[model samples]
Target: MPEPDPNVRLSNAEREALIARLQTATEEGRLDLHEFAERSREVYEARTYADVERLLTDLPAEDRALAVPRAPAASGDMVLEPSYTHLKRQGAWIVPGLIRVNPKYSRVTLDFRTAEFTTREVEIAVNLEYAGLKVILPKGAHAIDDGVILEGGQVINRAFTPGGGQRIRLTGRVLYSRLKVRYERRFLWWRW
Candidate 1:
């Protein structure tokens, strides 16, 4: 693989624009977070303007200009499969089986109690962060907001996940009771 370009990196504004476009793909369930991140990182480290332009020149053209770059069904393109697993309902609490998050996929899930006539399953996305995450802690407790602060200006704030990749080993914590941290990616669709 080509080494990332540090000298010709994207500006914050340009990076934000690219991310915004990627968000469109994510919202539409077109590009899973992990894939989005991989593509994003590649784009971010683009060395030449031509490379960046070509990279984004093929974004899906459809109703929403914000649509994520569809996997070019060119045979070599990878297919996206479902990433949800079963949710364990242990009395009042709920939990997922296992999840994985990477530069190609990230997801989020909400855990809650369910009433009769319903069973819920979900996978909370944590890695491959596009948007931030929001966390609500119980009463009389507190926690910090940074997940893993790296040295290369890369911050893996588990608190700001959009939720729904699969590989999950990271998360954010909100210190204190009744605390709601406004993260970027809040997976509201996750439930029990």
Candidate 2:
């Protein structure tokens, strides 16, 4: 697979691989426990491939190689299935035209506040079970709750407009879960 664009989002496996390298560095006496703990938090909080790479910039090239980003799936569509861990997609990562989120008993967040969109109109098909999905759209972006069958589930749209910079159509089923679409709270005061 070719190297992914630096703006691509890092997967859970990729984050784990980077952390594994950090663990190795700690064992090799290259990093102290304090540094390891700090870096580990940054790794988990990282969103884009560039963020992951930045964490290993001070390390040796051999260790940095473990942070190499992988290209998107050949299918073009992005599929997110987080079982237990929290899945967050934020920062400068590129958003595909189509995204299918199928989470089981996990909390998933797709924050597009500073993300790059490949398409003007994006479709998010969320099929969630016993999990919650929150989508934070960028400013001027509009979201439309097209058709999402709910079985004891709730869909909250706090940032849905008819037309705007980008259009997001939500579709699929939610069983005993919650789907929330809202804009980021600006300055911790207003939701814009």
Candidate 3:
């Protein structure tokens, strides 16, 4: 089989086309990163919609650089999925760590007793009594618990690592209320 042109960068027009397709699916909560990457890589080799995935699979590793995060430059009502890779711009590089929480349950509370940010520690205290739920979810949390306790913050601290990143606290009532609540989040530790 013929390899694709390595020198060819995706044209702005082509990138726009792909972005449009991805945006449509993302709005519907359908274009996940894995799917987006696969379809995008296929665009170079695709002869037909049905053949797109095959092109994606056949490409060399170098072809994968086409998947760039389209945020900041992306305009209007579109919240792009958070980037998991480290980013560098203007000679500065940023790496993301994890989240830290109390009790270490799948679900958590948000009403912080006192929410503060420090280079060493961060805290979000919540009144467990009125809280229906609370979860310290980062963007694209991937945790799929219907009643996972959390707050709805469009933006979160992406630079922090989840497991040991931040910390939260709740009163005794919060503990009891969370007793029956179940959370189903899978992370790297789960594999080990």
RMSD of each: 17.4, 7.8, 14.3
As a whole number from 0 to 100, the lDDT of residue 54 in candidate 2 is 70
Q: What is candidate 1's lDDT per residue for 4-29, written digit by digit as tens?
A: 34355444344434555665676688
Model 2 weakest lDDT span, ten residues long: 66-75
lDDT of 2 by residue, 1-192 (tens): 355578878776577567668877876889987898799899889998788777787889777634344443333788787676577877666778999999999999999988778888889999999999999987899798868999999999988876568899999999999999998787766654
TM-score of each: 0.29, 0.64, 0.22
lDDT of each: 0.37, 0.81, 0.34
- What order do candidates take by lDDT, descending? 2, 1, 3
Lowest summed lDDT across 10 adjacent residues in model 1 is found at 72-81
For residue 24, what is the lDDT in candidate 2? 73
Q: How far out, in Å, is residue 173 in model 1?
A: 14
Predict model 1's lDDT versus the native.
0.37
- Best of the candidates, lDDT: 2
Q: Which ranges in model 1 have alpha carbons more than 4 Å from their true place?
A: 1-9, 61-192
List, in order, the clash count of every candidate structure: 37, 0, 21
